[model samples]
Target: MGNVKKKKIALGLQLLIALFLGGAAGFFLPQFASFYQFLGQAFIRLISMLIIPLVLPLVVVAVAEVLGKNHFQKLLGKTFLYFFAVTTGITALFVFASYYLGFGQGVNIGQEGASLEGIATGVKIDEFFLNFIPSNLFKALTDGALLPILIFAIFLGYGVGQLEQEKKEAFLSGTKIWIAAIYKILDAVILLSPVGVFGFIAKDVATTGVDKLLGLGQFVLGMYLGYGVLALVIFPVIAILYKVNYVKLFKSIGDLVTLAFVSGGSSVVLPPLLKRLKKEGYDEAVTDFVVPLGYSFNLEGAAVYFALATVFLANAYGITFTPQALLFTVLLLSLIGKTAATIPSGAIVVLLAAAPQLGLPVEGVALILSVDFFANAGRTALNVVGQALAVAVLDSKKEKTEKVEKPAKAENVTGKELIANAG
Candidate 1:
């Protein structure tokens, strides 16, 4: 126990130190851009390698296993709706607030290195159902088409759920081993994360000097402002309302939160998250179902960033939207982009997808990419917090229901015994 605590303390410090060193290197040693970029890309690739084997199987297995239990379907329904509602509502609010604050007004749109010729058509409302079915599963996964991959996982999970009891058990057991083995490998990879964080931040700083960040200060400030409100105010209120002790909850999950912020990959922090949830007295069944699903489906952080970036870019390009148009643009893009877990640079991919359709200068993507490291720290941390809060809320409701049921049964038994004694 003592050794574990020491390691946890050391890990957090190491990441923080690495971030500081990396930023310093970038500010002071711009000539080493190539080396730091290589290091950053390698680290990102290391995390990306875990996506297919980890994400698809984890989703399928968790869904399949939970489907066999009582009341889980209802739990699953509530979980899905909760994530969707919170993500959509909060994201819309940020976009509107950022717009009203004039985040991107009077910015000159850079044309150099900006090519908008091949922007894929945005998702149409009528075609939404058909868009989920990829022409080729392998290609979709390779292309990082997140919605297609999730759709595939959902189908495969349903198939597994239909298996005979013994067969289903055997299959899930095998999956458990596969996931565990991958997590063990991931544990090894995590040791190199400080180095990865250093490389990633250094490269960003090297490529875009501090002055460029200052030029975009309004947008960055707005982004962080949104994060500050969500983390400090909104999430805590939700926890308090649900009867979860907010202080204790954050204290318990501090390590996972640090991992989320530093690594900027919420998927990579699942092992620690699950362990923490279990230790904090969440049911194994609830954590098992919610955590992985949260990774794939519950990216509140990414949703907020998407909304802010979209509106900011629109403002920069001097594009004005009617209220209805703004509603259409923000909701469609933000919600669609939230369909799956993001890779390290996934926000750029999402920006590219939504920008062209909204008449936002595609080049505006570069602005956000420059400050992605800082943005990602806050965004991914929120993802972890959102997941934990979802579980706590549901578990609290479950406990209350049990309490009500237990006393009623006991009272009925006591009443029946008294009547029999009187007779």
Candidate 2:
């Protein structure tokens, strides 16, 4: 554990150094931004390649195993409901906030002729629902359509759950093996993140110069503001309802929070977070189940950023969203945000994937990519807090349920004493 922590710290320092070096290169040597651009983009593509393989099997196995066990059914249902409600609610709130508060109003980073007008007029409510049901599964897989793939995986997992035990176990074992292999590949990809971060920052700084920094600053401030609301307001309300001491809860996990903030990734903090929860007397079963699931599904921080960034970029490009368009955008972000756990900086990859579909320019994504490290710090810290809170709440609920169902013990009496009394 000590060695792991040391290594993580070492990597964090490496990334920080890379970020500084990249920015300096971009500012002083704008002519070579193209090289940095290639490095960054290649890293993104490698991460993208692992997403489907990683997400599909992992989701399938998770759903299958959870559904197969009757004991876990209720826990699974509650966890999923909590994750969905919190993520979607936070996403919608930020979507409205970003639009009303004018998050990206004055920051135009050369992305002209891009508009959400077509989306406003063309996206029918029914069509949006239909998009999740792919007519051809093969085509959906080939096209890397996340929504359709996710819907299909859920159904497939459920089907597997209903199978005979032997068959189900066989299938699950096979899928888990595949998932393990993919995770190994994912780890390799993540080791290259510093290089990717450097390239992205250098390229953007060189191409747009310092003029774009103002817009980047605005976006970062907006993100931190949203994170503040979640940390200060939304999560406190949740903790209160669960009978948890919100302040104390955070204090207990402070080390993990710091690690998450510095690392800008949740994967590294997960093991220690789980250990901390267990040490704090949270239900091990609940922590083990919900914390990991929350990483993939309940990324409140990423959800907020997704909604905010989408609207920010739209406004930056001089587009105004109608009510219907805003609603569609919120729904799209809520769904895509679930994919943020597939890799480090996975939010950017998912956003880039959804950009063309959202009618936002690809260049807009690149602009956001340059300063993601700054945004990710706050984002990942909130992610760590959110996951911990979810476990705490669920475990509290489980304790309450167990208490209610527990049978009271009879008063103790010796056999001789009972016989004498009866006589």
Best by TM-score: 1
Question: Whole-model Cα lDDT per candidate?
Answer: 0.74, 0.74
Model 2 TM-score is: 0.61
- Candidate 2, residues 1-423, lDDT tens digits: the string is 556643255555667777788889999999998899898778767766776676677567656776765656688788899999889999899998789888898885664333323222223437667876889999999986766777787788779888999999999888878866876776687677778768867876788645445657888888888889899999999899878888988988876676466556666556456657866767655665677668778898888778888888888888888888888888877876665653446687667756777788767877776677778878888999999999878775656445433422225656664453333
- TM-score per prediction, in order, is 0.80, 0.61
Pairs of residues at least 3 apart in sequence or in different chains that clash in candidate 1: none
Tens digit per residue, CA lDDT, model 1, 283-401:
66677667766776777778778888888888887889888887887677655675434556566666776777777766778656667777887888888988888888767466645
Q: Indicate the worst ten consecutive residues by lDDT in candidate 1.
A: 112-121
Which 10 consecutive residues of model 2 have the lowest summed lDDT? 113-122
